[model samples]
Target: MRRSGVVRGWRLVALVAAALAIAVVGVLAARAVLDAPALRDFFSRYPGTTERPEAAPYGFPAWLQWQHFLNAFLLVFIVKSGLQIRAKQRPPAFVTRRNTGLITTKRPPRRLGLHVWWHLVVDTLWVLNGVIYFVLLFASGQWLRLVPLTWDVIPNAISAGIQYAAFQWPLHDGWVHYNALQQLFYAATVFLAGPLALVTGLRLSPIFTQRDSWFTRRFTETAARRLHWAIMVYFLAFTVVHVTLVVTTGALRNLNAMYAGRHDESWIGLAIFAVSLVVMVLGWFVARPALLTRLAERGNDVRRMK
Candidate 1:
């Protein structure tokens, strides 16, 4: 017989508990090993962070705070709507594109599920925000802070990873520079994973699929679908680890730098962070099918799929 929902939920909880216990024990064992004389000497030699270029940027700018907030806000909705689209195979309502632009002559009106329409809308906003972020990141010379400038970063990143795994996170001032591990992860998230998601998502989108070409035939829809799902999982995992580290390492200082654009130990950053969380939670609940169908019907023809 198939397992009931309650039984499955309990099983998931037990599985998560077991994983956490294993992780704790593993970290303790690694800590004991790293405390040995040989490893201690290695740690002393490499430390956890390499020296950054003299021209590297410092301090979180006000624009960065706004960008951070917008990115987070859009991401919450994007992920929520994306998951909704994925889970609900037969969308309750469908939306046919409204043709009005000059480009509409090239491509006819296309029909899509209401959930998919929501995902696409949020994703477009996220991409636009990312474009603005990239422009500012380069214009302000903040790219130097995230992209590694030397080969020494490899060893330093490894050292930082060791430190993190051993329950000894590297100490660094975020207002000035991030440790090697943080720098590398940030770079990968921004450049590599972000583009991967965009590319894969586009491959599965109506604009690309509506046309037939060598590229479309080679990159199958099934592959794009699977890769897109994997990218989402990667993003979710990254967010969990990033938030945990931010809170555990230096919650107040980090929050202040990112949210309030200040370097003080005040509680303003925490307050802002709490407010952002509330907004995200409200967005999660407010994005229901009933509300979405009504909103989507304003511009496009929305119909309940019989």
Candidate 2:
């Protein structure tokens, strides 16, 4: 189960043979479509023919807005809290730890513009982002697609990794199934990062900061800062991996579908796009019971396979 034909040093070169086959087939397919008047007419009717698709349902636009707000929040909080906490250090060992590790010990914290008012501004955005994210999870059923329900998930993920790395795929599932890393990442973002950011931010707030609330309130502000930084690092890394995966596999085909909401298999792309619709209307409908049943069935299937 652990072994796969895709990931290795020489397999990349070995895969040249298969790549050539694929390229030839692709060229032929392109020419056939190009020469056929019917195909041209059909594509004319569907300008997004395997090239462009829409991803409106992903809430990419709204998410982008939220990201902007988050960046502003981070900037305000980091700067305002930085000046206040840095330099001389404080009662909590973290102030020293943060400055020493993240910043060189050579310099003191900047005192300029270090004020309480800006701190409050930072806290407000943290609260606002918490509220927005809670609503986003409910409004968007994106939670369903990313979570791993089956025990087979881990093995499958590793298998997918090996195959991809070896430059071959042993199991060509109809859908481009997610590997383990993707599932783990998506789940972590949904369940861990969002909540942690909120809790840590609030805990650092002077209004609610307290020794008794150290676990959640007045929690290690430095640790929270570290966590926030880590999340951004993860986000940046994921973006690179995601783009690289799309390109290595097939950029134009997948990107077109994501952008315009149409792909080679129109319905599949539509269904994925429809995830956004489900997000918006998930709670209002009475279909929760049936959805639960379907989830249960899927769960049972996984167990059976195991």
Candidate 3:
């Protein structure tokens, strides 16, 4: 049985490797075609970004830097706890609502597994952070960086995608204005994917699923669960590609803009990035059941199931 399992694992790995190799070859062929005179002229006409409005503001503000770090921190644990909840067959501890809280509520607290409790907690925090981000994004006029105002965005996005696939990424000034591709991606992620994830997650949660309302009737729990997983996969893929471009295009400049809220190639941004990564890693490691149970017990009634 062990030998058979090992063989199956090797076979899967080989299949994945072959698929990746084929994809690389396909991309290279497309890149060659993009190098043609007509295509080159077209690319020159639409270099990636459309014209920015006269009122569009520039520079990564301090609020954006803090929001970026907070989002990254919350996402790490959210993904971790979500996976744990999905895979855990036997929960180590279960949480029930406190009967004697100062806050009044009609529905009693539902008993949740430790992993589920943690996932919900982190998810709530993430949602609140997202709300704050949206408020600040519009209030500070930073929405212009992401929201597509012109129809030219579609063609520019296509051009930018071709440039990326061809591995000819332009190290554009993201601090001032994002390329059409970046703008569209950011808009979709924040406005579409983020909301989709939240909606699907809520649909699958005990509060929503337990009730037999129109929402529950319209969106089945099974469908919500699958969509939620797909959204998570999208987020993972986005993070990988986003980080790869950030590092490859101009690591220092990108990091400076994101972390230090500056355009310079100073080490401060890199240092901050490194520290944030370490903190995230530590949080991942420390989120074991024992620690989680202790944290969950403070507000909820926790009982050891096993």
Candidate 4:
């Protein structure tokens, strides 16, 4: 009976996640029925509304520049607020788990004062950021940048995973142009985070509660928080990978793409973006132990043949 209950819990989570994904796809499709040139069309409309100069070729557009700045700014803020929510700690407060015995895991108190208030403010900004950015992504013909646009991405992530755990390199550096891990993470961010915000908002909304909506029936705010915690695994994973590479490469260069949009004055943030990318391909150099393991195994095989 206890085992059965665990299965039921897993099934419920899968069902809810599926429902959220479907709802998001439906909403995006309905919005696209308008079928303006593309997502870029929505933001392109903005250039004319403001008295800004037109974007230079291959240069960051005015709106795009502000968007990046805003994105990076909010990213830092969200990380802080997220930590305050339950900084560096994760547990019952974060996710729901299966337990048969009377023993169950618990979260430690991380009494970050004003965490309660900060959560509200940070999340509200995130929601606004999503709505506005999705609109801009649609208008700017830049969806491909966020989505997994290439087949190599999955294989790349697997290779990157191998590197992370066992410090092994499965393929030559030239085999992949983009860091497989980065591509996959960003792709999921678009698809997964997009829907999470909506469902969580509904689950917490007073208006929805008053109307006895589906969110109210399916999960309480506490349960919704748990779901949000599970989704946060993606964010946590990305942060680790992001920080590791930033320091592993050069903080200046990585900061360039994120800040001025380039390491030096040249072409803004494009060059460091390119270099930081190249650094991932050479990550095998940093984990020399993994490299020696493969060579040693090869030598052993050769000696056995002799």
Best by TM-score: 3
* Model 3 segments more than 4 A misplaced: 1-17
In the range 55-168, model 4's lDDT, one tens digit per residue, is 312223446546655554555545554555556332112211233345343542222223333344456776777778778776875554445554655554554553444333
lDDT of 3 by residue, 1-306 (tens): 999999999999999999999889878976886788768877877888988877878888888888888888999999998898789678899998786759546887788888888998999999998999999999988998889999988888888887787787854789888999999988999999999989999898887977998879888998999999999999999999889989998899999999998889989899999999999999999988899899888877899876
**TM-score-superior candidate, 2 or 4:** 4
The C-alpha lDDT values of all candidates are 0.87, 0.47, 0.88, 0.49
Candidate 2 local lDDT, 149-209, one digit each (tens):
6565555555445445445532321123344546666567656865665565555554344
Ranking by TM-score: 3, 1, 4, 2
Cand. 1 TM to true fold = 0.91
The residue ranges of model 4 lying beyond 4 angstroms of the native Cα positions read 1-69, 75-118, 163-177, 209-211, 263-306
Worst 10 residues of 1 by lDDT: 100-109
Better of 3 and 4 by lDDT: 3
Which residue pairs does candidate 3 place in steric collision? Answer: none
List, residue by residue over 217-266, the lDDT tens digit for candidate 1.
Answer: 99988999999999889989999999999999889999999999889899
How does candidate 4 score on lDDT? 0.49
As for lDDT, the candidate ahead, 1 or 2, is: 1
What does candidate 4 score in Cα RMSD to the true structure? 20.3
**lDDT minimum window of 10 residues, candidate 4:** 47-56
